[model samples]
Target: MSAITVIINPYANRGDSQHQIDAGLQALATSGLAFDIQLTEYRGHGAELAEAAARNGAEIIVAAGGDGTVHEVANGILRAAEGSEGVASATLGILPVGSGNDFAWGLGLDKGVDLAIDRLRRGQTRIIDVGYVEAEGFPAHYVVNILGGGFDSQVNIEAHKIMRLRGFAIYIVAVLKTLVIYYRNPHATIRFNDETHEFDMLMTFVANGPRLGGGFIAAPHARHDDGLFDICLVHKTTRRDMLLMIPKFMRGAHLNHPKVTMARAARVEIESPEGFPSQADGEIVGNDVRRMVVSLVPQRLRVIV
Candidate 1:
């Protein structure tokens, strides 16, 4: 293995992540590993840096930011290896410095930067699945954790409108506001494998990992290497019913609710009549999506857990 390249997104966590870079460097130094660090100057810079590092013979490319940073880096590495020989694979590592480290939580990489760095230093790797979202008139993209459409996507957009809060608090406020103003269900026609169904759905979550929006375990049975995605559809419900189900999401027992339906599929397509918004890994991608096709990429990346 060659040297590790750590790509830090300085803008993550609303500028609270600068200290994590320092902590990561100190931990790497203590581990006596040969590595180089690069700070991303702008959006999508981490992906470029990771690609360059991999092409230059870097053994590992570490994303030292939040889920967005990790997603970009992973996409870069995968793109770089598209036609390359099998021997030239670059593994991915993560240092969770974002507000909602959803991917990190799935890998059991908690908030401790030093511990995460230590795990990277030890060089343990696991093969994990990745998800790709193909929408009409848009480029295909990857998400490490969860993706959603309809009400959840609206909530993601509204949450970012507030600049002062982070993580669960932002999501909570956004959900409350959206619930009051955006309660109409969108007509969604979904096709999964050999089955087809249509519903008036409040939201649809296609999950590769179990958690999203900080701590909401939206898909309790999702696993990255399962070669399938757990799709959760929340059908239109009364305001009182939705309010009652919100707490069950925290306990990860909402799947048992009658209004919620869960299914596992290798491929799923969703068509909505009202052109709803969509979100992947906490990033909102705009509104009125006519169609979305989600597929799984099995054992796509080597991740340190």
Candidate 2:
């Protein structure tokens, strides 16, 4: 029952997170800080533990795994603050022991356990924006890094099936697998910043940070505290065209591609005639959602840098 709670996802990074737990906790102990640990036993367990901790008035709740872990912890903290007045949101800290620590990478927590612990001990925090998605049949989800629909969501699905590869390579292989297995794009109407656009799109991602899947620079100009989401639209294109664009995304040069559209907005509405797959922070949120609204909550989450 310490003030700082650390939620660890045992299966994250293919179980490497569990293996690294000792060293991570040892570092925290060496920092002379009192804390408590909670191990997630199943999907979404992190959020459950985090929510309980935040409600109990934990000052700092740390996600001791990867991006998915961070997403859950953030959501739990956000949910606890809902309808509660004059309560400061729990601060989030990352230990970054997962495979694709893209969100942690953006927060400068990818350096390893010791550095992340040092960051926590220093107590310097940044207030950052987080995105929320509301759709029928699904509870609201918080997107701390990126929320991707269509092609990228399909890629995430494929990536989950891959067992041997780790880190960025898994996403790279999944992208190739997606091209061969799921190539059809969906027609979507997107409204944001007082403008409307309708077209067949391969993918649309609303980003709070610059990277996804460990290395892909999906939104190169994104920032977490900007109070807006960086939205990228990938227009439908031939397989050959998609293959060519992959490299550009790696370096974040795809922003200028003729088929790609980049814009910043505080909120966005997406609707598709054909249902499309969607994911938030690398976790599949829905497989056949026809509509959803993504809006930025400005300076909502506090994170230890």
Identify the candidate with maximal lDDT: 2
The C-alpha RMSD of each candidate to the native structure, in angstroms, is 1.9, 1.2
In candidate 1, stretches whose alpha carbon ends up further than 4 angstroms from where it belongs are: 84-88
Residue pairs that clash (backbone atoms under 3 angstroms), model 1: 275-288
The regions of model 2 sitting more than 4 angstroms off are 85-88
Judged by whole-model lDDT over C-alpha atoms, candidate 1 comes out at 0.84
Residue 97, candidate 2: Cα error in Å is 1.0
Judging by TM-score against the true structure, name the best candidate: 2
* Candidate 2 lDDT score at position 55: 92
Considering summed lDDT, which 10 consecutive residues are worst modelled in model 1?
79-88
